[model samples]
Target: MSSFAALRRAHADARFKCIFLRPTLASQRLGCPVSPFSCRLNSSTSESHVSDAPTEETPIVASEKTVPSGDDTLFHKALTPSGRRDLADRIIQDGKELHKLNVELKNLQRFARSTELLVKGSPWKVAKHWFATPFKEDVTLDNGVIRVGSQTVPNIWLRDNCQCNSCMHQETRQRLLDTFSIPEDISIKTAAEFRTAIEVTWSDGHQSTYDKDLLREAGANSEKKAVIRQGQVDIHLWNASIAESKPQLNWEPESRPHEKRVDKFIQGVLQRIRRFGFCYVNRMKATPEATEKLLRRIAFIRETHYGGFYDFTADLASKDTAYTNIALGAHTDNTYFSDPAGLQAFHLLSHTDGKGGASLLVDGFKAAEELLHSDKEAYHILATVHVHGHASGNDGISIQPYKGFPVLEHDAETGALLRVRWNPSDRAAVELPLEEVGKWYAAARKFDAILKRKENEYWEQLQPGTLLIFDNWRVLHGRSAFTGKRRICGGYINRDDWISKYKMLHFGKEDVLKNLAAG
Candidate 1:
């Protein structure tokens, strides 16, 4: 019989005696005269008959019962036919599960036994048993780490990261091997370490290598880089002083300069936007199409009811206050947009015979940060409250804005300021509770005061051929009322595209890992 079968038989016999057998001395002490009913002490299961006889119509029924222990089970004897079947099935199932578990345990032991897992000069195994696997691959020791491939990785990690045709999907580039699929006995076939990296041929005959520096950058020390993302604005709060040397970048020459010069100009403009969240471009043709071309160089134009770009000339039909020369408040262009435009660009095509049309800018993030510090409760209220914004009119075009967002968007984990959206004109009527109404108004008023403060305002009388772009989510823009003709044209770019472009320009290690996982 198999070892498991013998073990199962012994277990059953032991349990049978425990339930059905009793000592002769014990029966005698109970005053039940020991006749043929006495049990043998030496045998495991000494069968006996009860003194009380059964009638002809009745027969003793056998039964087996089970009890559970913390991690194992036990069976009691006198098993019925059905009980014997259950016991057999349970024993088989338990044996199978136990065998699987033991295999995993043995795998771990074998892994630890391999010299590939041992540190240099390991004394656990004699030199003879250490070189069981040979490899044509190279290995390396780098900066206090034993590198496998270019990374200081464990043997299991190396085994898991195998990227041969069988291990990884060709089309998706994702690994196919799972923990269970990688057997416990998996090991390094051959390995070596070098100055810069490590290489190993796995027991499966697949070779892999890793660099030392890349692995460290990929894990453990990545917390800081994980929090901040590329293309996310690093807002620099500024006041009126920003206008003196404001974020300014000149446009490419009308004659079209050399490619290098054009590249430099475009790079400078993008970098300026990264730093100041806004920039003023110079020397562009005063036409709608030309303005679009300039904006497209940065990103695609975001379209809306206002069309591909807005011409701020005196117009009739649109419900927007922007079409009129009325003084405008500092606010994001699309407060009613669910995913509001990330950036807004404006090109001053012509400003012929106009007065009091100065553009004003307020760093909403800066203002929100101040509110967060001065009245943390109020800040919390704003961040938590869902303020709705909407815009509608009887202008035959069936468009009505209905969007909601907190005035101050913050990182949930770190409480860091992220995006700021504050637009009073487009703010839908609030229906807060009587008590909460007053507090909300107070918070709103305080935030407004900070935005209008002279220290937070940057006004400029934009001249012709000047293109202004700003992060609409971070910086709020407005205009003073104008008297005469003032024409302008510009477009919007989706935030994701700009971020993608920025990431390409400034790709980081985290991005690499994210892409790999996505695949």
Candidate 2:
């Protein structure tokens, strides 16, 4: 039997005497009858009798009869010297047993709650004894699989994920034990389940305790695991109509230590950028240093060939068209990078003597989705064709991915579109077979046309003190032709870093690992 069940059984068999309290003089004045402390204590399951006036030695049998008020004689039933001593001894012994029973019950409840939450998404239905101490009959080991409660897990995976302090650094959450050191033919010597966790002893003499929840999650499918890691942020794909109600927030300078006012504002900025692929932070100081400080709140400025936290005018300092007074088509930045920048921030510090430098944004993911439904073949070609992109405009700055990537990239496991790498200006020569060349160009042009469509573009004349941050993977950015100087300041944030900040803020630090591990 489980320890909790045993404790309950023992408590049920014990013959304990409980002293009942009747209404005192004070309670009588308040018009109260029997006090709540007046509880019947049954020494045995069988019914018994209680005399009109019983002595302490006479068992305090269960009775519903209420003693008349002011009957002092019945209230203070005299106890013999020997009876008083016996009652006191039994009271002390039963109190200790009762405490033990309560402790056991509390532990059992905690185990049940934890186990339920952990195995919530499991395919197998949990049996009643799921929280009990697992025995030989409850578990099985065969063909390198350990089956417990109808759920099977690989023996190697279970051994590698040992949560013992010797195997894993508790504070750092890093694996101290070498995974390869584990035996390839590892076997379980013994396995036992408790209310909240499972204990396994390996044939190699290493022991580990695995939480039931972690086990279920590790055994889950790929798509469910991805959801855990990415969280449930609703992505709102936008078109030109988004201009009527843009995702934006107002920035106010922090005036005091640990000020709570800016907490909501910062969270608002992150949520907007995450959901809509971009957000604008208005009413900030129009300076390079100020813009850098704001970007640092999300993550450190990511340095590139151009610079870290850059501030520039139309001076061609980087030998790129972006540094010229010309209109650029909608395209994602850093297509040449293997792991392109995740987020890009832009703050038009000043645009004096400029007529039309309206910033343009196109939702690449939305456009890709449209292509997938409207022209599946075109979408497939774009997703499959590996496009070579490069940045060789500046001296000694030829940059390209080691392996070319698709213009429309999707996650291999989930088959969900993840990134868009489209920058015609920076694309390298087509390296495809002549027969496929025509098809590739046709598909590319079709996607480009979708991006440049009037209904797909959201344009705004960015003003000084209005900062914009966008996801470079999902949003294609461009600028209209301008007349004179148009000063801008911004920088890139690495994909992993910005996403880390978002996950940390969205799901607290404690849960970030739980989700990431599942994925």
Candidate 3:
């Protein structure tokens, strides 16, 4: 017989003995006792007594019986006395406990699964991973999808893709491409897809893959569209022509010949002014005569400082002069004037006497552009808010006016930016409702902080005879205080005169004269 079968037979024998064997000392100790009638087993041998006694017709009674056990009985023996009555009760309780534990375990597992799914499904998690990855190397593009870093973007922008040479290289002179009608059957295959890498498939059966870093460097989203026009004069030639025609001032000897050299130099300076909003004329000796001549040659000059022709002058030797102060913060000149100066000319007549007097120029336009791109809502708030500038010092000149000019304005025709107005302390209370005041303050503060950064500052020392002219409306000028003596001559040319001069030199003599008459 098999081992399992032999073990089963032994257990059965033990159960039979416990149920029907004679009452022994060991059986009583185990809490099990043999029945009295069961122990009398010689029925056939004692048949005569049984028949005579049975003939008496003794009545058989069926009554529930209990077996008694002492307090010292073992747990197993007490549980299974003779019949399976108490053992069945213990089994039912154990089965109920096991079922309750199984249910609890299932509930815990379900909760864990839900939590895992929630974290995996969050968009914030996806974005965080995308930004943290190194994105400057290569961009991955396959078929129609573009992958920037870890982000997989859809191909819906295919129609907007600009690959023409005119759009790609702005400085190049190329024929503009003719516009074509889009095909009606064009359809995108997928909205977005992400894998170990991106795959893009075009409808024309063309496929492409690009490294994610390279795609980012290509500036896919930041690329701008510009219209290319033919028959336009080259910028260099145009500048040269303007310089050749420019008038020369008499204060300083022509460092170059009046006809050939001065015209070329002036043209170069004007080009720089137009392109950068400011430019420097160097090599002229620093003197009051030279500064005055330079200012007059440009156009009529504005006298600042309460009807004073030399409204602003830097005299380092004279402590009484306003120009000797070293700690001048960034500000636009003539805040008190009814019409603020449009252009400012500063001629450093002498710099050898000063130690720390360095000129600092900031491109307010660039700062404003950064603000617009990073926080558009803030840019809008600052742009729409009205600010009042009042200057009340020395001779008591106070002028209040309202202007809707933005801190940053774009040229309507060329789309070039024109930066204007950056004076935080002079900013008047905004006309916005009380509810929006907090938001306005926050935005203005952010803009000012960006402008104050050193990265935005262009530092230079004004050498003697160096005349620096800048668009006063768009450029903010400041200086660092020095201990030594320094002298400078400052003045302004009205916006009308400057524009008239530009048009006269570029557009035509008639247009220039008409604009001058209109002004």
Candidate 4:
């Protein structure tokens, strides 16, 4: 018999004695005589029960007829004080044994379930002792594919993604193996499925081991792939109504007891920014240093030609319209750059002699959706036509992407909107062909109208000590003209940096980062 079978047999015999023999033996020791009829019944039942497997219906102890009394009172009264203590200890010991048996039974059930899975087949199994069977009659071991239950993984793919230390760097987690060196028609020499993992020896004699999780991922279907892609950040589109329920996080004091507040604050801010594209940090110190420090929590500051971590008054110090006290319309900053800033933060440190410089924010995504539904032709034009922008206000400096980009960018595979680049002030000359120029102008007007709608604008006169951070790629920000010495302190963060932080926070420690890290 197998070790498991031997152990199971031992448990049954021990349990039967503990359940049926303990009462009779303890009663006889305490001077409660066993009647002749009880002795014959016990002997016959015990002899026959030795071969009978213990089950839930098994009596916890011998029947009361075996004892010289009708109830347990006579047996208890017959026991001395020392005997009573011994009896109590015996009960506890038996209880422990019963618990162990119950645990072992549960393990046996799980083993049976896993065996059933191996026989019937499953797409994926997370059991401790998992096994894989061949997928079909035609699928053999030496073929180019290895079957794990119902899933099939190509030999080349398995060899290329080997997680061994020699193939993948342990510290950096980057592939060191030459993926191209492996033959396109590679085949498996042998495959062995162990209790916990599958091992495959390639035709070239290179071995690779895959755990259940890795195996499942290697054979995931298109539906599962879509779910995995869409599982990250959930975008919540909003218009003016978002102003009523502003997404904001309160700045907590940096005391020892409240140290965890920093983590909560950072997570809350990132989650809100990801969902709504903007969030406010209220009750901050409002200093340039403080704002920079808080922003660095998410990522390093993105330096531009103007400066990094800039703090300036409305003095035109940078020779840009944003440095002046003019009412700028809804537009995204740095539209002229090849890769615009990902996140932008602003804090109204002080605003002396100012009355009407309330900041305006518009959800470019919501406006784009409106355009898509209201006029498909205009949306198509905006999505297809490329536009150029420039930042040449500074002396001896002109920045622009080598080629123009579309106003509405989208993910090719998912057809989901990815970015919006719109800036009327910094827009360069229209370089479209004569025939398409009119169509582009009409599309531009339609988009501009949707952006300017009253209900689409979210206005707020940023208060002192409050910091407002928004996604520059999705939320268009501007300010009303004012007459005052308004000083603002803020900076931009690189898109890739903040996105990395958000993914880490959202997914925690998982294989979701394997592809992200490779990129």
Task: Give all candidates' CA lDDT scores.
Answer: 0.60, 0.69, 0.49, 0.69
lDDT for model 2, please. Answer: 0.69
Tens digit per residue, CA lDDT, model 1, 1-519? 543344346344433332332443222322222211112322333344333221224443322212222212223221244444455555555445444544455444434433222232211121212223222233455443454345455657657765556677756667777756666666777666656556767776777765534343334222123322434334466777887888887787768667667656766776677657788888777778777877776678888767776776766567678888899988886777777887788877777785888899987766776775687566656765677776564455543245457787754423345578788887874546565578778888888988899888989888777889888878899989888887778888887766665554455535544444212
- Ten residues in sequence with the least summed lDDT for candidate 4: 122-131
Q: Could you tell me which 10 consecutive residues in candidate 2 have the lowest summed lDDT?
A: 17-26
Cα error, candidate 4, residue 459 (Å):
0.2
lDDT tens readout by residue for model 4, 1-519:
533243334445444544444344422332212211122224323333222222334432445544543556534432344444444444445556555554455445546543443453311211101212211222223344566456566667788888788898877777899999999988877778665567888888888877655565445432233333432344677899998999998888645325356766787898798778899999888799889989998899988889899889889678898999989999998889879999999999999975789999999988987886687667766776688999998899899888888898764433456689999988885666676489888999999999999999999999988999998989999889999799899999987777777766665646554433212
Model 3 scores a TM of 0.47
TM-score of each: 0.61, 0.70, 0.47, 0.68
RMSD value for candidate 2: 28.2
- Output the number of the TM-score-best candidate: 2
lDDT, model 4: 0.69
Q: Could you tell which candidate, 1 or 4, scores higher by lDDT? A: 4
Note each model's CA RMSD in angstroms.
19.0, 28.2, 29.7, 27.9
In candidate 3, stretches whose alpha carbon ends up further than 4 angstroms from where it belongs are: 1-264, 306-324, 352-354, 402-405, 409-419, 510-519
